[model samples]
Target: MNRRMMMLALLAWACTAAPAVSAASPPVDDAATAQALAQAETRGREMFEHDLAAERATDALLKKRMRGDSRVRGWITEPKDNRYEVSMIGEGAVVLYRATTDARGILAGATEALAVPAAPTAYQAGAAAARTLAMQSRIDACAKRYNSVVLPAPGATTDAWTVYLLPATTDPAAVPLGGSYRFDIAEGRITSQRAFTRSCIQLKRAPRNAAMIVTHMLDPTPTEVHVFWSLWARSPLYVTTGEDVIWKIEDGRIHRVQD
Candidate 1:
């Protein structure tokens, strides 16, 4: 109630409050925080490139074949330096392939090389089934390939993950197949995968040509990539040579390929 008592009470409050306020205050080194962010970005880019190189090597090795009927082609695009496009050609024709990469380049995934069927022999019906099975096998192979690349990375950040998803082939004769993949970074592993089929059909009228296209779009932080495919055309009256393939990519390695 006295003046001295009031001053003492106020002093006690100020001392207690000061420590609490200081403890609650955030750090004030703006420059240091900015430097840390820059370092993370730089490190992310370097890791992305390293991963990309390894992916390219894996693709090149897989492209080599025993019968010489299959071929693989690929290229990388700019800015982030982690995006890529890849394709597989079979029997001088485009079969099936995928294109993908990430900001950190630690994850690169691709589809399996779809095999082109040899001309139907005297056993036409049986040969057609065999060829269809072969194409399906290739799709399965691609799924496995993607799985192998992505499953190795774990704790991968958004910038560290890469994905490649192949929609079911619209061509019934090609065995109607589709699948998808996702990769991790921290552990350098694959996070998930999926595959499916719709129906079965004959390939008597199926075309013999196949081709793939991959585009890498990287800039302004997040990167983008695109994939396209061309397949032989077939019809009742007359057979067309091939159909144009079109698709798009976003944020590093997200792809939208046509079915």
Candidate 2:
């Protein structure tokens, strides 16, 4: 065919192809999406709680070890039955201390062990990898000044990570406002990121332990960082998103409630 004729033929094909391509993609179901988000937030909270319990149970011990033991790099947590196991990971993939702790911070009979099993489990490996990447990220700079959390991604059995960086504050007169970030990572690469605020905002805390409301415009839905913040504060955060969706993050979980 001539060049002009070929161009017209290709144009005709393109006109016909558009509808089929559109038809191939299924429309998003909002209900399902909301449910999925709830599930993800729940899983994220679960993982965070596991690490938190371990930290509470072993922080003093870990503090001494971290200060003196050069081999201690970081820690990993795994769910074991009704309890959670904490392992102080060391150089060359060894465990300096391993023990299980319950929700109340009661540790197992084995308070300390070189947790060298036959091999590292996939769950522990995922937690470890997330911790490693988090330690290596640019976020590391802010960690010493903020409350940073690294958790395994929900629905990912392996090789996925979720990170939360929150501004830490001790001033009783000021409430550290949103200057948080949540990152979704896969196989050592960040796939997506959401920042809670362009920069940190600190509001005066007149009445302490009072309920706080946050205008979250960075995303359509509130993220796990919201949950972590609420958990850290031991207070509920009423997060209003751009879509007019109000999510309540309380007691380490997020739920949508009527505003």
lDDT of 2 at 2: 71
The C-alpha stretches of model 1 lying farther than 4 A from their native spots are: 1-159, 165-175, 178-186, 196-259
Clashing pairs in 2: none
Per-residue lDDT of candidate 2, residues 170-196 (tens digit): 675555655666678888777886666
In candidate 1, how many Å is residue 116 off?
A: 34
**How far out, in Å, is residue 220 in model 2?**
2.6
Best by lDDT: 2
| TM-score attained by model 2 | 0.68
**Model 2 clash tally, residue pairs:** 0
lDDT by candidate, in order shown: 0.30, 0.59
Encode model 1's per-residue lDDT on 1-259: one tens digit a residue: 7754464354335333432111111233487644433443343333344335435534554565322433432212222243543332233333344344554333355434445433322222222222222233334343223312111122433323333333334444442122322222222233333332222221232232222222112111112111111111121111111222112221112222223
- Write down the lDDT that model 1 would get: 0.30
